[model samples]
Target: MESPPADTAPQTPALTYRAPTEEDHARVLAVLDRWWDGLGGDDGARQRAGLLPRLFFQHFTDTSVVVERDGHLVAFLIGFLSQSRPEEAYIHFVGVDPALHGHGLGGELYRRFFDTVRAHGRTIVRAITSETNTGSRAFHARMGFTEAEQSFPGYDGPGTTRVTFVRELEP
Candidate 1:
């Protein structure tokens, strides 16, 4: 079997971002699983999946986003526009394939999500992560989010303190 020349081989499409859809649930979960798997064991990965419930994609599809390359899920951000605060959008979960870390895929997903919510008149963006998650804290900081004035402790569950971050969007 002869291989095609490098230049003649099929070229993967550039990373693309899009709103989530009902049909993307399984692949999204698989990506999450792969992401969590890199951090630890299966148990932790399963727990992480819970953070990305189907309802987010099914109902808040517009605010949520999925990034793909050659039709493979590479990253995603699950968020929604706030009903109580029409000017706000809340990002509940975000994940990037570990192998692609340092490549800025995570940042791209966030920027896309920001542009989307901002287009809908949302002027504020919020997200939360455990206080222990320094990686997340640093990433949020780099993305221009600041610690909320009144960050709540144990926001996730018992003994699970959280750091709340917010970003003010420009019109």
Candidate 2:
């Protein structure tokens, strides 16, 4: 029997997907540093280098995933596997080069992330963002993440009023 007509749609160029190696740290940090430099206050800056890693980073390997298209870096999602449960991932950072922000690279990165975690038997994914980062909060919401927690501790920085989000994908 003749097979159904092959899909005529053109394939999107394969996104080069991989973990951020030590070599990628410079490029990734370059993007992050620029983003941080654009911030307008001293509060959040103070929290980043000193307070964050002790409270964040350090434990997650491949915590940063980069997406390269056309041999050029376009986007990244930085996070790590978690220990709270046998199957969970904590997303610490996700950044789309400003030039590519609205072009769906971020979403694609997230899709890859979920698939990677699911393949490893992970059941849930979690992330954090600042309360006033309306743009990011909205994006997470559209991605089907809901408000799991929100905190405002009267700290000196912008993200002191932080919002946490979570998505549970399985039992």
Candidate 3:
């Protein structure tokens, strides 16, 4: 098949980033569904909703960020400032559309989150992922987070061990 003329080809859509609102809950969940569709069998399916609850998104609307191109939710970072550690912020969940993986979207999301939190007077950012999630561990390292303390046994529950990572933001 012949390719379309240069001017006739569609232009890549520009991604728009903004703070997520309560209205975006459905779209965000749908994006998560797509991103985690086949990963963890029955256990994964059951735990997905609880992992990033709708109520958390509704409550922490300001700190969260979502990126979209055209009208779809392409990536998201759901996070909030820590009440106990006033200088720290935590990333509760973050996901990028599988189609956009390896294109630096994840780093962009983390950068945006860092900027947002820093603007709010947060000096440190923290996040956690499963011990088995090597991909996430590497990504966090690339984003400037180092393992915080030691891996926690059953941090998420009875059987889930999690690796916590922390990044100190510039004031």
Question: Model 1: how far is 131 from its true place, Å?
Answer: 1.9
Count clashing residue pairs in model 3: 0
lDDT of each: 0.81, 0.69, 0.85
User: What residue runs in model 3 are displaced by over 4 Å at the alpha carbon?
Assistant: 1-6
Worst 10 residues of 3 by lDDT: 37-46
Ranking by lDDT: 3, 1, 2
What tens-digit string does per-residue lDDT give for candidate 2 at 1-171?
Answer: 766556865556676877766566556655554555545365555454343342232344454577887776677677767766787887777877776677787787787788778777887898887677787888899887998877654434543777888998753
What TM-score would candidate 2 get against the native? 0.73
TM-scores of all candidate predictions against the true structure: 0.83, 0.73, 0.89
Model 3 per-residue lDDT tens digits across residues 40-92:
66676566666877787678978888898998889888999999999999998
lDDT of 3: 0.85
If candidate 1 were superposed on the true structure by all CA atoms, what would the RMSD be? 4.0
**For model 2, what is the C-alpha lDDT against the true structure?**
0.69
Better model by TM-score: candidate 2 vs candidate 3 = 3
